[model samples]
Target: MSHPILTEKTVLLNANVKNKEEAVRLAGQLLVDQGCVEPSYIDRMLEREQSLSTYIGNSVAIPHGTEKGKKNILRSGISILQIPGGVDFGDGQMAKILIGIAGKGNEHMEILSKIALVCAEEENVSKMIHARSKGELFSLFDGVN
Candidate 1:
């Protein structure tokens, strides 16, 4: 990314979430704590999930707020949840990585594009999914964005 959308604090490793909804909320809350978005943003994120699937393959799912929920955004930022056992993102798509994003404008697409680009390579995605530490995750993303 031209600027960082995610940081070490925004990444969760071996997180404990029962399902997709829980995962989204956990990731969204991280963004909220970071001052990136309002608490309401998580509701909008779930709304998006209901209307359209965010699953981007490679066991990754990108969840973002709906157009109506844009008002809740305070800044452009991204949060990542790494689930070692994977979560079912509906439709039989097992998502091992759940990224919750709240962008304050066109930054939304920019962040999504960056993540998509990085995850486009199966090898890179695998590295990210299996990264043992925050430093390792940062190293994987630093090379691409």
Candidate 2:
């Protein structure tokens, strides 16, 4: 069986998280639940955050595993977490949208670029943050990449 990169089941809306770590865990958990990656991948995601912030500005953050975490990836997957309340990503950067990614092989680069493009627009980020339903959020990501 094959899974789509972004599924409704993986898109969480109105998530309330205390901090970036908790946010990353929620996003990573979605990918794991979807059979996209191993359980250990979440740790690497945290490690990556510690090394460098994934907060890309415009109220968006993209969290992905380190190079070593690649081994834990079962397939390419993207998880979206809509945090309307927002979480502090350190350095005064509060991210309202958290995108967790697990890509197989060289697919991560492509996924990153596509996500970057979508997130670059402030309007799109606002739409994602305020999306009332999973379907609404899914529509924002439709045809992405």
Candidate 3:
């Protein structure tokens, strides 16, 4: 495979968000800042969160826009929000890593699958949760060039 959609610019360290909504917005904004999606994509991501929690396993949450959100994406990429303090993502899941994705096409499934592969191993997920820098976090990602 190739490098995951996540880039150094998109990874946030020690993000300060009080709740899941704020976390989603903060990370989604990174996608906007990268010109991957429009500002409204933030709200749409929140909507997706409300309908169904994106909290994957290992204290991580994958926040993304709804299907309608596709129209807002200009490019494909992911925004990583590392909240060491953790946030409750409903269902009693406290998410420490927020991987916000804005995939324009195949990038969505591709990135998601790669993330799944990484998270499948407990050690890998732990490494990501404790990663303090973008370089450290990027290293934990699997199947990436």
Candidate 3 wrongly placed segments (more than 4 Å): 1-4
lDDT of 2 by residue, 31-104 (tens): 99999999999999999999999999999999999999999999999999999989999988999999999989
Which one is best on TM-score?
Answer: 2
Per-residue error for 114 in candidate 2, Å, reads 0.8
Rank all candidate structures by their TM-score, best first, as comma-separated numbers. 2, 1, 3
lDDT of 3 by residue, 5-123 (tens): 67888899888888888899999999998888999999899999889989987898899999999899888888888898899998788998888888887778877887778777888
* Global lDDT of model 2: 0.93
**Candidate 2, which ten residues in sequence have the lowest lDDT sum?**
136-145
Candidate with maximal lDDT: 2
What TM-score, computed on C-alpha atoms, does each candidate reach?
0.93, 0.97, 0.92
Report how far residue 87 has shifted in candidate 2, in Å.
0.4
Please give the distance, in angstroms, between residue 17's alpha carbon in candidate 2 and its true position after superposition: 0.9
Q: How high is the CA lDDT of each candidate model? A: 0.85, 0.93, 0.85
lDDT of 1 at 78: 83
> Which segments of model 2 are wrong by more than 4 Å?
none
Candidate 1: Cα lDDT at 68: 98
